[model samples]
Target: REKEEDGLETSPSKAECSVWEDLTLEKARLELNENPDTLHQDIQEVRDMVITRPDIGFLRTDDAFILRFLRARKFQHFEAFRLLAQYFEYRQQNLDMFKSFKATDPGIKQALKDGFPGGLANLDHYGRKILVLSPSIIDRYTLVDILRAILLSLEAMIEDPELQVNGFVLIIDWSNFTFKGWGLGSLAGSSGAEQDGPVGQMWLAGRNLPMSDVEALYANIPHKDVLQAVRNSIPDTITANLVAELCDFVLIHSYFRFGDNLYLQIGRTAMGTHMAPQYANIFMADLEQRFLSFCPLTPT
Candidate 1:
């Protein structure tokens, strides 16, 4: 069938074929606007930076390893380093998560049964991976285990060249979902809530935590301590909670526009970036309303 499709003389020329055949090259051009040599040199520089940073570990010379951080920070060396450092720190703080996690693990398998988190069978138009999660499918299980399952699945997909260059999309199905499933009220006592008021805004999807797990973690942490810690990280002029809310936004500029459901689109910014600040603000506003309505501000 593929041969038949390609056999037509009306088909694209050799140059066009080559262009489509090598998506990595196109991704580099589209996202970074850099030629092959330039991208290679930049990757080398980023690799060197990661190696020299005494605070970070598991730093590899591999293109994929370096590109993850570089793409996440839009190739800004300092910003990428900060995010990379945070990634390591977060993993270290949660040691149990990385220990022997694999896609075939039983916990992950069971979580799959719950539809706790599921990866779609296809990529998006740009060859990026698509991950779908329906909160309605969650069963009576611990959030951490479910999160581990999801991460294991994502880790399995991370090495795909298409996904590496193009990145991923996360679609959260809010249809039939309510405050109970969202666990919004649960954020009040957590340290994150004291600072950010909700987990939805506290953590970036890929950078720090799985969306659901982070949400639950924020809901349950000691709010007072969390608030103070987040406050210390920001300038004195901004309210700590406000700063906390904006922090994740600064890290992740692309977000889903909330309406009947939520659809979030993300890709490598270093290539061609989408800076949807206005959409993010609108989404944040809707999120705030949800928090206020479902999770009222009462003394935790």
Candidate 2:
């Protein structure tokens, strides 16, 4: 078939054909159900869906902008529409972040310099971009600042059609950080005891406990093992699958920084975010359950 029928031909050149061949359009068709024949039709359908929605007021209805959401959601019109709505809604709700959203903004520039979410030059095995993030950097900047830096990186990256299709891989390095850094009180310190709150009371109680003692309690539970445990424990249902996908999205896109270089946390989940503790607890529960089931004697 000619380039006109397949919708790959933009210009009449042999070089363009070679470039298209190297692109992931074939993969998109096979995996994401993207049809070059119905590409314009799909875009129009999503556009019409957007046009009818009075709630999603004044969104950019251009082909390029609308196509991104469609590509992200694998050409599913409703899912694409929902994602588009959420995209605009997020921007609308967080006006402060988007009001002066630019590369030159001081906070964003600083966050980028600190490598809060650093992009790797090379793509991964699957041709997806790899972003590195350091949770320790989170303490240095406001959540909004860090978010803006990430958004900036993403905005620059999504321009590539290959990236739009292949997406991204985030690696969050949890190293070079402490419990106190993660908002948890120090395990052995008067500093933690000085603070006022339930956290302070809890810290005061455990202040005498040595760090070695804490480490000894779960030193055997490796980070990779915990992730595997979580994966295995999730039930195989539609809701469960969605939850699993969301979790995977979070883990895969996470990245971190150390010194001047950025590193990917290949082993364990980072501390700092609320989700980290929950993720740890879920896997821990799974591990405990497995141990109890395997043990012959029941002991309290």
Candidate 3:
């Protein structure tokens, strides 16, 4: 059976058999809500959606490729379809990043050599792969190249079935990182108390939270919610309405320069802004307060 599946005339060795068995066991443990009996149907359903959507462009409709998105979204066909479209759309919009998206690409190779996203050989207790990043290296390379390196690493790692099922963790070391490196020199130059206020506290707290959590919070944050969070955090001497208006302006009209073109940021907060960190921290704190009030017994 293994020989047939693997397209080999000879039987797989003991090590290969053991690895397959381990992956099967790990899949069972992860329980991504994927029903083996219905998995083919699920994959077919998503593939069918992809076929009908001309806007997403020609995508790899192979079982393995579709299955990765399914597992990531717990086999929800619609959500997986949406993710598939976004995946292609992102690549389309950022042609430069994906142009030579390979480990050997000069820019990517340099970033990898600089340890932009260093990968660990060992897996976590959940059998998930771990990747580490050091922010201090950002100053040495363009952000696009760093992102390419990280994407290349993830693309290579995701080929493992166990990693697809269990996922991965990213560890970012902020040691020796400076505000200037993060494009926040203005904030760094502020008074000590201001520099160490909510933004500083959130930066410390963020180290403990999963990157996905932070991303999800910011991606789906309503403007009104952010305004309310800002309202609650500002000094009484400041006019709440005026601050709220300023916050709205920042959120609605945020833009950034990439290469020779300027791009407006949508969905999430603008990257590398002094106010961005504070807004995120304030909103996160508001969420925690709400959660605590709703569930008093839950540990902080």
Q: Compare the candidates by TM-score and give the number of the best one.
A: 2
Off by over 4 Å in 3: 1-30, 186-300
| Model 2 C-alpha lDDT per residue in residues 1-300, reported as the tens digit of each score | 237766764443777547655678887888788898999999899887766668656458788888888899999999998888888888887788897788889999999988878888767878789999888656666667888889988988898888888889989898886555544546664455443332344344424333433243232446556656666777766665566677666665667788998876554455644567677777767867887799896444
TM-scores of all candidate predictions against the true structure: 0.53, 0.58, 0.57
lDDT-wise, the better of 1 and 2 is 2
Tell me the deviation in Å of residue 45 in model 1: 1.5
> Which ranges of candidate 2 are over 4 A from the true structure?
1-23, 187-300
lDDT per residue as tens, model 1, 1-300: 133555744545678657666866667666754456677776777666665667656535577676666766667777776776777777877888877676567776678776667777656777677888887655344566678888777767776655656788999997776433433333233233322312334443323221332333322334243334455544674676686566445434644556777644333211122433332333344444556677655222
Worst 10 residues of 1 by lDDT: 267-276
Instruction: Sort the candidates on TM-score, descending order.
Output: 2, 3, 1
Better of 1 and 2 by TM-score: 2
User: lDDT of all predictions, in order shown?
Assistant: 0.58, 0.73, 0.75
Ranking by lDDT: 3, 2, 1
Q: Indicate which candidate wins on lDDT.
A: 3
